[model samples]
Target: VEPKITLTDKELQAEISELCKYAALLDDSQLEVQVKDGVAVLNGRVASSYQKSYADLLAYRAGAKEVDSRGINVHWRHTNPLLRAQRYEKVTDEDIQAAIQRAFKHDPRLLSFEPQVKVEHGVVTLTGDVGHLTAQQAAEQDALHTIGVQRVKNNLRVRWPDEPASDEQIADYTRAAMTRDPYVERHNLNIECENAHVSLYGVVDTQFEKYHAEWIASRQKGVVHVNDYLAVRTKWKPKSDAAIEADLKDKLAYAFVDPDNQVTAKVENGVAILQGTVDTWYMWQTALDQAIAAGAREPHCLIEVRYGLPSGPHYYGPHDYVPR
Candidate 1:
């Protein structure tokens, strides 16, 4: 058994050395290939974002039945070199699902969204509207990353494709972004050019409004970056609301006619005092009107007139009022 295993290791190594040379020939693909038995793994990097997808194609064509591709992709800003790679001995169904789920998670645009993808016999079938054309393509490319995936059938639709758009088509992909999006209008969100960069300065009330405005600016082609400084806040509160309470003492001081009735009228940041009022219905009206007209923001006042009525305290609702 030991001798057989030794021969197997030697065979796997030789296969890898030969495949590595072939992988180097692909366009802009810097992949370092390794093989163990019939399985293969590709390491290193590619320049285009599409390198990962293209590299996987080469692996299968080289007669690899199973693949391990964890280190096949690395971002442009990545500094780490590929340490090592080897073909996985066993490929499970969970491996494919894990790879698919990974594609959705790591890709920034796909994380909070869903796409109808059907994986069967290592072939991925994609259907449904994925917000935009680019996301649909990204999902397909991601499916191709899995070890056993044979092919991808892109049945996905972009809800809108005819309208002229402004996105750079590579950076944020705003044209493809606005199709299934609920906010953007076909012709309303105008993107105009200014010195190679686009600036959006406008007012937006709803979240959809802000999203559409940003999308329109983002869609403008030749745009290196979008500079959006739009206003979204709105005034929904009153300018001033004053709650004032006053005792009968203040009202009595204001109305000079009522010396017996101590009355106080509360106004907006103002005070009305009435004194010497022996109450009648006619006198009450006369006293209230005087306080309102003389001092109040809106000619409105809350009047507390003490008629000096002789009565015992009764609890109508709240706390008892102690007579001073």
Candidate 2:
């Protein structure tokens, strides 16, 4: 085996600075980076707390032992350099319904089953039979993320196969699957099963891990329902509501070519609430993701997606679906 080559502090700093310069969410012109003894110090004015945390992640990825970001200040008064041009167009219930139908037809998981999708005033109702619990949830998410969808009513039933495994077998399978999942750490994780109902009790490091654990259980052989009691225990100190809100705003601003004043965010008792109108489903999802990155718990999204008349060529075709 070749000898391991460790990057020096100078090399790490240079690499991190280059990474920042190319980072779409960061304004490297405003940043000053220094590294000494494997510790990276960042001094800059960024628009959001999410951006600051992103820098920390980059430093760690570039072999830095620690990162000090106290010198970074949040500046939200400026517009985002990458903001997309605002569009004023109309989206009807018919458009929403049609989009969902196309999505269902294109989805590899939904290909065999034709889930009935109805849209009334932007609210989508899904009714059909899916082969698995994950398929049902995936259908709901597809509708929820679609443009012009205000709400999703998932009435789809999971039609489990006739051959069923025992509860003990299911529990064992779920545990084994979770252990194989790179994102899920089995430490303190408890999996219980009763008549096909799976309950997860554990402490996870992030919200994604908790959700992933539930998903892993739901895909097991005999699982009919998943009761996730997993709690997220963040490693970092909790931030105030004001800080989280500021971070969310900055993150949204960075996502667009212009500061999207139409979007507004607030945090109430650690729950981030996003209320806004965006021209596309992408922007709407970006707002919610930013809220999560800002350290909010179960961020509520009330954003509206208004499909605009295409200024350029736009397609509604689907890409290859990867279930994982």
Local distance difference test scores for all models: 0.46, 0.68
On lDDT, the leading prediction is 2
Best candidate, TM-score-wise? 2
lDDT of 2 by residue, 84-169 (tens): 11110255687667656655644566767878988888788999888888888878876774556678999998776588877778
RMSD for all candidates, in order, please: 25.6, 21.4
Candidate 1 lDDT over 1-324, as tens digits, reads 111232343454444433332232232344666667756666776555555665565454334566677776657643223321222224344555555665564455565467676777767787876555446656787676555566889787544434533333332343345444655433222122333344443234456677556655443444434555433434333222233233232443555443555454444444333333344323444444443334322222223323311111221221111111
Per-model TM-score, in order, reads: 0.27, 0.45
- Against the true structure, candidate 2 reaches a TM-score of 0.45
In candidate 2, which residue pairs clash?
A: 82-256, 82-257, 83-256, 83-257, 83-258, 84-257
